[model samples]
Target: MSQPKARRSQLISTYGIGGLFPSSTTSYMIAGLHEWKEDRAEPLSEPRLARSLKVVALKQPPAGGRKDVPVIRFPYTQVCPSCRRIGRLHELSKDWNIAECSKDKQPLNPFRLILACRRGHIDEFPYFQWLHRGQGKAGSDHLMKLEARGRTSSLADLVLTCTCGVENRNLDGAIGPLADFGTCRGSRPWLGPETEACEEIPRVLQRGASNVWYPAVRSSISIPPYSEALSKFVDRHWPLLADREVVTPALLARVAELSDGKYSVDQIVAELDRRRGEEQEEDDLSEARLRSGEYSALIEGRDEEDIDADFVCLPRDVPADFDRLITDVRKVTRLREVRALYGFSRLEGAGGSESNLCPLAPTHTNWLPAIQVIGEGIFMAFDRDELARWADKSFAKDRARMLKVAADRNAEEYGHAPKHIDIVEVAIHTLAHVIIDQLSLDAGYPAAALRERLYVDDNMAGLLIYTASSDSAGSLGGVAAMAETDRLGNALAEGLVRLSWCSSDPVCIESKGAGSDALNLAACHACVLVPETSCEKSNSFLDRALLFGTRDGGNESEGIFSHFVASAVGA
Candidate 1:
């Protein structure tokens, strides 16, 4: 038989015909590298061999994969043994291709090339030999011995060992898998680099096969009731997940430890939720994209105040029976405890309160139009005909207060007080008759679950009153009083009708029209809206002055108008 190739080992020494080549086994290599077990859950390419290998070429730089984002990628060229041929690989049966290598480790300059090749055949290439000492009859052996007794090299495909003791074909890949060996060497041996070297002497070569690729003992992050494929996925991602901030390594280890050997999805999810509200939750190392304008506020997993309203954390397990998991999740996570997060208000400059309608001038300005929009949005979202039964009953308990808040806000923004007949009122009125249905939630939710956490900012609750009024044209103080009075009117309009009203300051009129002529009648929802006052009580000086702005015009009728309104009111 052709001499088997040497098993993957650091050559302690080397020699040639003249004398011998200087030694090149490494300090680090002699120390030994960490073992990585192959993902056996992945379907095996071959089921006959208990050993396969992965090799890499250290000379060639990575093509494109090694970048800012950390992703595990296979390289395409490498150094090997016996010949100068690169450990050629034919991924997916596409024509044979050169394996990839890196420059970080020289002796391993071939890197993981052979390890990537599942089949046992080394591609046609010269291998940079790692040689060791040998003895000859004269005294010392001058050259490395080539012992091919009678067998020739065959073109048969290569095979490998998996973590589960399965000998599978490693055909289209460069990474070889690790599996348990039966009887240490009892199973059928596949051809590999020679592991025997002058056993009569210093025992130069290692005695038997080793668990190459990845070592098989990982006590964390497993998908229950293992299938080869899912185990592989779990195996690959679990180590990476260990470093993630939000998905704590300890949490992963906990699941790995708790299940004895298998973890269910519910267990994983429960652990995740426990870790979520913690101040030291881990961050996702992977660059998973989020919404636009969503800032990096969840750095250590806690909001500024130690909580967040956005996305809920869930376990990172893939259970085949997810439907059942959902049932369990519902019981574990209460629906009432759900709350949608509140980051949108960051874009809204007025802070998170409805108390201040005008960020610029809270007390005197009435931004009813804005309040109206908010009301409309509220109605569309929560006031549908079939909604009350499903509405959060807790929120329903404070429904009246919610309306009052909206109204107070509307009055402040629009310069008019609000009434109980606005858009929001109309919508909630629609919801008043509907019944709640707890079963409707049984259907999978198409909407995000936001009720897990909600918060209102404490900064937007006060008034920054901006007032412009005519006190007394006769003096600045008089002008100031008149201006303040005018502002109060605007606030009422905003709070009541949800409309913007131009300032009704009579100061805008000419000096000739100063007293009564400057006043103009403005019709509002069938009633004449001027300064607030009694209809027939024009007897008061303030009422007369305010009504001066709402009388119908250029007439003997002007004088006749007030008297007629007064008599009509009395009647």
Candidate 2:
């Protein structure tokens, strides 16, 4: 059999360890990280990302050469399309080259349904139990067969039967809350013969369901100093400087000399101290802390562009039309972003309990799978004073409170931490989406290829809209070119105008709560919602009413951007 192939980047973003993918022959699941051969894969160095994940290093997914990332057959059960005889792959296959039914000599297809739990365990559906309803015991000689009535495409039309004189049953109620597929055995097939005791009830799911796998990826942008030549050199020799007992002034001086005097001993010492300080503050290193560094580097632009540097930023004048609402603009000509896969979750979003997270490796490993993409972006910082005043408005407060109530309810129902919904965050997030939608038309990239990063907090209100891909198209500079004063001003004005009315209006404009978990108001696909990949919050916490005034029952409420829109239209 020919080994299947996948891009190294896909391993981290879409199909990491334990993810399922279909090949020409059959479906397979990526093996656990332990099966990956170290020599076939190369190591990657991203200090901030490594520290955030609490790992010593990162590695690319194994590719090329003789051996690559390993995979294992999934759904063990295969059904003969002709005779409807069901059995394990080994039983049906005459040999490795042929997987034909033993009785009818027909090609076998993998069972469409599998069992999974919220705790990330997966197993083959218990056909025997479903056939007899746990009333009959199956012997080695017993055989099970699946028969479809061909009446409809629903599970109620599919029936499972056993050779024993036991009653058969349909597959109805196997996918919903009424399902009695039984408790999970905690099977971790990707990790070999390992099983843990679990009480989570397994739910029946199609092999290709989107909710089957959700990679918990954490990414960081390479910013100034960190993306500088000095930083790269220091990272290359990190092990030597990391050891305090072996380090000395002589070693520092020798390292400085090796740099051809491009860097001084004092500079190396400062960088080392900075890394040590980061290690000491590891506990305080949250997502906000990570973005804070990027925010500062972006707002305080660097003009000296080193051709070889991974990141380069130049401050641009804010468009005069938007100057009152926008504080600053930075055109990111060159940028590198590193994304690492820490873990994954099944049957839900990645924000659930730690116990629900599936390990990438069977045992502790010092490294994680990661990929880096180079891209260009445009960063815009909003006026803090103006935003603060808007957030204080009674209507904005009421809207925020309504979203918070919905978020609280969603958190309680989904078993995840509640999101802190603030008016400023929502308005900024919505603005990012609206602009991204507009940029997709003017910018060269499609909406899915573009991405948004929000920097919102007590002291920060900004967003970076960039297209980062593992391919060369990521650096086309189309996005950054839009940062030009006139272009950006026109884009902003057009975006607000487009969002002022939605195709799903009055329902859309009057929507008090909409979207998943009712976390949005006056926002839908026709207006502000963008692709899930483009949004940081999964398209949540958005309200066009907050950007443009709402009219409910003849009472008008002015929005934060209503004045700007009015001024642009000469209203």
Candidate 3:
């Protein structure tokens, strides 16, 4: 299995880190790092791969007795170009640089095609079986070969011939809506011998095609630090301190012994007392847990003196136009973020299936493979009263109704509804994009590098747009600098002005359900939509009309930010 070297950020965002991808010759699968339980003699001393996102690589010994670690292998079947015979290549021949047909001595080619279904199942192309599908002896042993009739590279020009000497099939009709490929075998080769029932017809795809795999990834921002200092200490040392029994008298004795004089029993007991109301688990990424922490962090404003702390929040005076609309503005000078890849979908958008992000597997693992990024950002805390007042307006309700209907229809078609994010959240999210774009120009960071973490729920209305990356040279401070009073005010004014009209305006602002899943109403590439990585919602639920007026012949009502724009212009 071969994979392209990608940046740590790209691995988290574009091609999933612990997900499956393909290359021309093989289907590459990345397994969770937590699953690598091999002994590490010098773990911290292990050198990181420069330029590549791969954190760990263990070599598999040539010979094995109950292999310590699972070896990654992609099975290959060979096709005889001369005799047109196809069959699985023996396991030993996997390392061969060149393979020849057993019967004809002709050079063989690695089978370049595979079968996959919308359910994310993938299997080797059924070359022999496909050519003889209708025949009674289709399952009988027969030599299969791939032959090209013409000098062209098109699928129509390629043909599959069998040694049964009677039938041959063209590669044509292997794709498209009416493709005749057989039902999906529901093979999850990446998971090793995993199979499931899939009724969807398989589609023939050349190895490494974009449609082969789509990863579903989830991420969360660490709000201050969700755990108490003692809880965090226990979590960091859980592997050593954890036991089958609860923290009983005997278990406490064992924990003290395991601590090796690092912490006394009295100290540990005190910490446990402090942990009573905290999350019991070491690694808790529950949706409710994450959202609640973030909500509290946003609503309960951080003190100005804590600006030098782990999660710095320095308040900025609101611009005159935004004084009534926004209640607080803070510069997040330091923050930590964790992104994890759990499962994936195929042939369909990952956002459509809400279940993919849920516990797809039967049981939960203690840990999920994660990448940590430390960065600087700006947070905008919206005035809840003002937000509600705007949302209750007749036009705002009408717009929300239209968006809700479209979203519901999309959800019904896709089998699950996207978690409810209100129109106000959409407004904040869209503005986040606008400012991110403007900051890209003024602050010198690429637009794709900036990320938005929306803090919106029943209790909180705010967002933090930050520069997040796993790179060593983190937090360039450009983003935090822009959060200063004068700079942030100017950035907001410019961002709104830019969102007022787009290069594709009128069409962009007026379109109903126009972007990636027909999710956007008035947003388009030229305006609010940012890189997929930058957006928390996959760039959905955005409407420029909510920020600036729907000025392109649609609802002509001024937006929530119109006061800021008007005030800026007047100034």
Q: TM-score each candidate.
A: 0.15, 0.92, 0.79
What ordering of candidates by TM-score runs from best to worst? 2, 3, 1
Candidate 1's error at 9, in angstroms?
24
Predicted structure 1: lDDT: 0.20
Candidate 1 per-residue C-alpha lDDT over 1-571 given as tens digits, one digit per residue, 9 for 90 to 100: 1111211111111110000111132101110111111121122111001011111100111122212111111222333333222332332113332222222222212222222111111121111121111211232422221222234332123222222222232222322221211111211012122222211111011111121111110010111111123232333344334345656656677656655665565555453343332313323211111110011111111212212111111212222222211111101110001011111111112122333211111122211000000000000111122222322233232333444455455456643445342222222221111100111122121111100110111111001101111111111221112112233223222222211112443322111221222111222222222222111111111112122122224321222023333433345
The TM-score leader among the candidates is 2
Cα error, candidate 3, residue 506 (Å): 1.6
Give the per-residue Cα lDDT of candidate 2 at 447.
88
Residue 261 in model 2: lDDT? 89
Write down the lDDT of every candidate, Cα atoms only.
Answer: 0.20, 0.84, 0.64
Extract clashing residue pairs from model 3.
84-144, 84-145, 85-144, 85-145, 86-144
lDDT of 2 at 181: 58
Q: 2 or 3, which is superior by TM-score?
A: 2
The alpha-carbon lDDT assigned to residue 540 of candidate 3 equals 85
* lDDT score of residue 567 within candidate 1: 39
For lDDT, candidate 1 versus 3, the one ahead is 3
Clashes of each: 124, 0, 5
What is the C-alpha lDDT profile of model 2 across 288-377, one tens digit per residue? 788998899899987756776888888889988778888999998888889999899998878655667899888888888888889989
Candidates 1 and 3, the one with greater TM-score = 3
